[model samples]
Target: MILIAESGSTKCDWVLLDTLNDKRINTKTKGLNPAILKKKEFKNIISDNETLSEYKKEIKKIYFFGAGCNTSKTKNNVHSVLNSFFKNSTSIVEEDTMAAVYATTSTPAVVCILGTGSNCCYYDGKSIINKSISLGYIVMDEGSGNHFGKELLKAYYNYQMPQNLRALFESKYDLSEKTVIKKLYQSKTPNKYLASFAPFVFDNKEHSFMETLINDVINLFIKNHILQYTDELKTVPLHFVGSIAFHGQNYISNQLKKQGLNAGKFIQKPIDSLIEFIKKENAVLQS
Candidate 1:
């Protein structure tokens, strides 16, 4: 049996695949970014997950690709937790963007992530040749859900938002400045809290201001992250993954086309693709 996981700042999807019977089980848990959570907390999160507990001992290998597994220290933290959780299983920690690469295509391409956080990379078919240093939500989650949500909140609080939209936001969320501040500073998962507002933005995308906002956000992402790759990378297709990309596909596609770029695929979640990649790779190993 093997377990594969894709994790973002907000949540994680875990797939348990029993090779013998070809049985599969899907499970979800709150995000476990090693960069954000401590080892004990990470262990607790896994232990509390009912699905993990059910097959902890049975799992022979775990392929974990996550948001904060970029650095060695972060990877070690997650590795320690997984090791402790499933003593009989071996764990491999990897970056979330790499998961996007595997999910999108096997050939060389530029892969971008625009979910609760943002990142991009140059994948040369077999390996990642280049990538940006994603500075997390607070500093540089540009074009992500958190970025859109933060912009919306700022505009609303500053009275720059249209009265109708402001009224709609007030009526729908009933969130005061005090509540927002408390959640941001005191809450554990502030990124998730901020990203929760993305749905409202997408729903109002037809609005003039919304179109401008989305365009600006997407443009900034392309300029700052994806454009940094080598000139050779520009020749390949550009693939995207995450909620923001999937939701704003049309807008993103238009922006890319305007810039003479080709849009490849946009996946809201990469679990299915990850599952397929893992299955194929494991099958090859066995053969």
Candidate 2:
């Protein structure tokens, strides 16, 4: 049996492939970002998942692709935790961008992730070359869920948001300064807390405010991340992976056209496609 996982800062999706039964079991768990989470937290999260715990010994191999696993330190941190839990299994840990690349294209292209956090890399058919080092959600993540959430909060507080939208936003969430401060500064998972506000923006996207907001964020992402691969964009398509990119495809497409760049694909969840990609690779190896 094999376990494949694709994780963001907010959530992790797992698929257990049972070759003998020719079946797949899907499960969900909270994000396990080695950069943000403690070693004990990783063990706790996996142990708390009934499905993962029950099938731990049966899982011979584990492929984990997630945010914050880019560096050797972070990758080894996650690898150690997984090996401790899945005693019989050997784990392969990699950055989330690898999963995005595999799921979107085998050919050379600029792949971007716009989920709880944002990142971009140029996959040159065989290797991932990241020009910009992501400083994480605080200093970076231009057009991600957390970025949008931060913008919304600023607009609401500065009285820049439309009156009607302000009313709706206030009614939907606790906008009190105390609560906001506590969540942003006091909470362990501040990135996830900020991303929670992104659903409201997506839900009310029909509004003019949302349209402008989306365009602004997408433009920043293109300018900062996509444009870094300016030379490559002339030949290769820019592929996006994650929920924010999935929801903002139209805006992204329009923005790309204005820059004279090509838009390839928008994948909301990469786990399914990543699973198929791995299967094909295994088949080719065996053949």
Candidate 3:
């Protein structure tokens, strides 16, 4: 059996393919990004033998694509967490951007991930040659759901929001800015709290404020994240994965086209492409 996962800060999608019978069991797991979960915290989640039996040990091989699994330190931390789950399974872990590349097939392409956070990588079909800055939540992460959510909050609290939008924001989220602020500043995992605002953006699609926010997010992404990678942009076409990128596809495509850059393609999920990746790899092994 082969166990594969696509993890963002918010959640993880797990697919366990039992090759012998060609059966697959799909599951959803909690977020295990080391950037968010410290080593001790991760240990408790995975090593909590009380619930391990539910996950089972039928998996023989494992592949993980995740956010915060970028640096070796973080990767090892995440690995330790997952190692508990994939106990008898051979696990290969890599950054979430690699999943975009593997799913997109490493063409001369720019892969953008816009879930809780954002990252852009230039893939050559063989390697991730370049990656633009993803300075986490405080600095970059422009064009991401969290970024849009944060902007919406600031607009509401700063007395800058129109009355209609302000009312909608308050009624929808039902969260006080003071509580939000304390959570964002004082919590162990602030990004998770900040990302919680994404639903507000989704719920208020027709609001002019949303349109402006989208435009601003797109502009900042192109300006600071994409165009900033001057040396790499010329090398490939752009492809995007994630809920926000897929939902805001038309707007993003139009924006990039306006800049005369051909945005490659967009997909709502990576599971299909991932299955294809495994099939192709299996073929190569057989050959």
Candidate 4:
């Protein structure tokens, strides 16, 4: 049996496939970013996840792609937790950027991730060659959910938002300055807290103010991430991965078009494509 997982700061999606019987099981659990959680906490996260516990013994090979898995220290910390769970299974840990590359296309392209967080890289059809330094939500993540959510909160608090929208925001959430500040400063997952407001933007998308806000964030993303790449990398189409990019396809595409760039595929999740890639590679090996 093979278990493949794709995780961000918010959640982890797992696909457990029994190759011999051709059976597949899908499950979801809380997000586990090694950079954020300590080894003990990471272990607790896996233990707390009911799905992982049930499939713990059955899984023979584990492929984990996650945010914050890029660094050697974080990778080792995560690997240790997985190793403890599936002692009999071989585990491979990789960064989420590599997952995006394999999920999108094999050809060279500019790959961008606009999920709970944002990241961008230049792929040379074989490997990631260059990457924009993701300064996290506090300073960067320009086009990410948290970034947009922060902007929304700013507009609402500053009294820049239209009255109707402000009323809607107050109706849906606690717009109290104290609550907002507490979440921003004291919460363990502040990014997720901020990103929770993105749904408001998506729900109120038709409004001109919302439209302009979305466009501005996307434009900044293009300028800071994609446009910073060399001309050669920019020649091909730019691809996107994550929920934010997938749902805001029309707006993102329009923004790219304005800059004379073509938008490539938008994959909301990469585990399906990652599974297909592995199966194809295995089939080739057998042949």
lDDT of model 4 at position 232 = 54
The numbered model that scores best in TM-score is 2
Candidate 2 achieves a global lDDT of 0.93
TM-score, per-candidate, Cα-based: 0.97, 0.98, 0.91, 0.96
Task: Judge candidate 4 against the unseen true structure and give its global Cα lDDT, from 0 to 1.
Answer: 0.88
Task: Give the winner by lDDT.
Answer: 2
Candidate 1 stretches with Cα past 4 Å from truth are: none
After superposition, the stretches of candidate 2 with alpha carbons farther than 4 Å from their true spots are none
| lDDT (tens digit, per residue) of candidate 4 on 1-287 | 88888999999898988888888889888788998888898788788878778889988888899998988999998889999988879888988988898899888888889999999998888878755566688899999999999899899888999999999899999978899889989999999999999989989999999999999999999898888874855477688999999989999999988888888899999889999987786678768
Clash statistics: count for each candidate: 0, 0, 1, 0
Better of 2 and 4 by TM-score: 2
Report how far residue 73 has shifted in candidate 2, in Å: 0.8
Give one digit per residue, the lDDT tens place, for model 3 in 126-147.
7775545567988878888778
Model 3: runs farther than 4 Å from truth? 43-52, 229-235
Cα lDDT computed for each candidate against the true fold: 0.90, 0.93, 0.77, 0.88
Candidate 2: Cα lDDT at 15: 98
Candidate 4: clashing pairs of residues: none
Model 2 Cα shift for residue 48 (angstroms):
0.5
Which lDDT tens digits does candidate 2 get at residues 164-248?
A: 9999999999999999999999999999999999999989999999999999999999988899899987788889999999998
Q: Worst ten-residue run, lDDT, model 2?
A: 278-287
